[model samples]
Target: MKDRLASGVSIALLAALVAGTWWAADYAKRAVKEDPPRRLTHEIDSFVEQFVMVRSDEHGMPMTRMEGDRLEHYPDDDSSEVTQFRAVSQRTERPTMTATSQHARMDQDGARVVMRGDVQLRRLAGQGRPELDIRSEEVTLLPDEDVAYTDLPATVVNGTTRIQGRGMRYDNVSRELKVNEQTRVQIVPGSTRPAAPSARQPSKG
Candidate 1:
């Protein structure tokens, strides 16, 4: 009888141990399943100094050229930023466009660029249109569309004419410029300043 009792107790202990191990394992699995994964932090993954990037046309001609003192890329948003940024766009038979700023942020594939701090934009003379120049604290450029705009106060100069407004939009294709609220126009009587020097073809870097 004592032997049978000992055997029964051993069996019960072994079953309990097995059950406890299974419960612990199950609890651990559940805990792991309930936990969330760690996310990547926003950081710069790459950077370059004195860099230049060019986008070419189907004919292998450089259409848009960009250069800067420094370029940093953020993987979190897939954006690139440049310091002392400069860009030029020249299409076949289209007016040459140029932009410069203290800092610039470029979106995916550089389709859109946001320029800040003493932004300067220029549309050189072409197709009988006078050269257009703009000064602002910020500007957004769409290189492919040949468009630039700003909501901040801006000053635009065309030949002897000067325009000031709080918001401005310019389309190189249509050669249309529009100024929003608080628009001011000043036209100095003079022969449109001699056409701006012919734009030099941008060279690939």
Candidate 2:
């Protein structure tokens, strides 16, 4: 009788130990498994191809035009993205300006535009100012404010002057251009390049 009781007690202890070990292993497995990844909210809700958007002034004059091969809008942030984008500005009394980029993002109201990848800006010659061109990797534009800026390396060409700098800023309305850091300026000695002849202009006699 004594031997049987001892054996039974030993078996009970071993069973408890096994059960405890299994429970611990199961708990560890549950803990090691990560929770399911949270879904991202940056999904595009709408998109357009060959998109064109124009903004006009109160006097019914077009101030700006934006075009893209594709435009995508996200409902989560009320922002829009564009691929192969180009923007043109013809604000009153200001030099006509154009911008092109591989990609761009605009705010909900189109007040701001951020361009990336091979960004280029061009300001047409007007009001005695020579034509200006700028190239950069990225640029930020505030259409309402008539301001554009970049913090990356940039190259500016104004008439015969070529400037290389680390950063740049320009105000369309004010016609002011600034370089954040002085890099180099190459001034080609020559008159401004002449405009192309008009297509309808008669050949010289």
Candidate 3:
């Protein structure tokens, strides 16, 4: 009877030792594990300099191209900003257009670009379309739609004729330029609008 009791006691102590060892191992694992960190609202995800990105249309044609000296992306806001930025639009219905700005903000999956600080936009002469140029303090560009607008003082030139306005919206699809208020008009009398190409069109850059 005494021998049986001694054996039982030994078995109980062994079980407790195993249980304590298991618990200690689990505690060690949990103490060393760490949780993932949460991102802040303004946290930046990426940054680059002399960056270039090109986007294509559904038809596999290059639709928009963006280039900049510096680019920054914020994952929290799902937006991007660029310094010394330039963008080019290549749409089938319109001539290739280029825009330059000291600063640019891109949003909504790059469908919209807001350009600031000495914005200049130009459309290369092509397909019988004369060269068009615009200079403004700021301009909003929609690359997919080939549209641009500005509410600040702006100057637009077609050939030798220049028009100054406080605000304007240009739609490449409709081939219309709407001005909110006309400020001035300058024309060189001897110079005429560039004649549309005949059978041969000028090559565009």
Candidate 4:
């Protein structure tokens, strides 16, 4: 009987040890699976997917339209940011202009936008107007004024005409482009249609 009692006690102790080990392992697993406490954070607004922004002219006409994959607004600076953004501008006398970039920033109710990372601007062809393209690393745009500018290296292309410069300003309203520094123009005289006869210098003696 004593031997049997000893055997029973040993079995009970073994069972308890096994249960305790299982409990310890379960506790450890739960501890590792639990998520850490979230930090306190606040923002005015944020958006993911299907983000659109529009800015209108003083006359209440739609001047610029912007769309993106992600948009975030910060009340602290009254500014907004966009990821994978594209924008379009409209004017009465000229073809619609569009821009695309990897990221963008805007303030003052999107009156102005600054875009970065492989920026490309294009003028849509319409009513015998030829298409134009501008490529740059960065650009600042005033859609209300129908203007865009960049201080970085820039390239402008239209048909077989190409312009390269360090800084550039383009006015969609007036169809004018001003290059600030290190400007070069290449035109295919026979193949490419002439675009800016008004900008040519007069013949000299």
Choose the strongest candidate by lDDT.
2
How does residue 4 of candidate 3 score in lDDT? Answer: 96
Model 2 lDDT tens row, 63-176: 899999999998778899999989999876888999999999999589899999999999998777778899998999887777899889988887777778787888887777
Better of 2 and 4 by lDDT: 2
Cα lDDT of model 2 overall?
Answer: 0.84
lDDT of each: 0.82, 0.84, 0.82, 0.79
Model 2: ten consecutive residues of lowest lDDT: 196-205
lDDT (0-100) at residue 85 of candidate 1?
Answer: 97
Candidate 1: tens digits of C-alpha lDDT, residues 1-205: 9999999999999999999999999998877856467565678889999999998877788889999999999877889999999999888767889999999999978989999999999988767666789999999998878889889999888777677878878887767677775467676766543322211321110
* Residue 85, model 2, lDDT: 88
TM-scores of all candidate predictions against the true structure: 0.73, 0.72, 0.73, 0.68
**Residue-wise lDDT of candidate 4 within 4-71, one digit each (tens)?**
99999999999999999999999999878777785445475665576887777678877788899888
Q: How many backbone clashes does candidate 4 have?
A: 0
Best by TM-score: 1
TM-score of 2: 0.72
Q: Clashes in each model (backbone N, CA, C under 3 Å)?
A: 0, 0, 0, 0
- Pairs that collide, model 4: none
| Pairs that clash in candidate 2 | none
User: What is the full ranking by lDDT, best candidate first?
Assistant: 2, 1, 3, 4
Q: Alpha carbon lDDT of residue 100, candidate 1?
A: 99
Which scores higher on TM-score, 1 or 3? 1
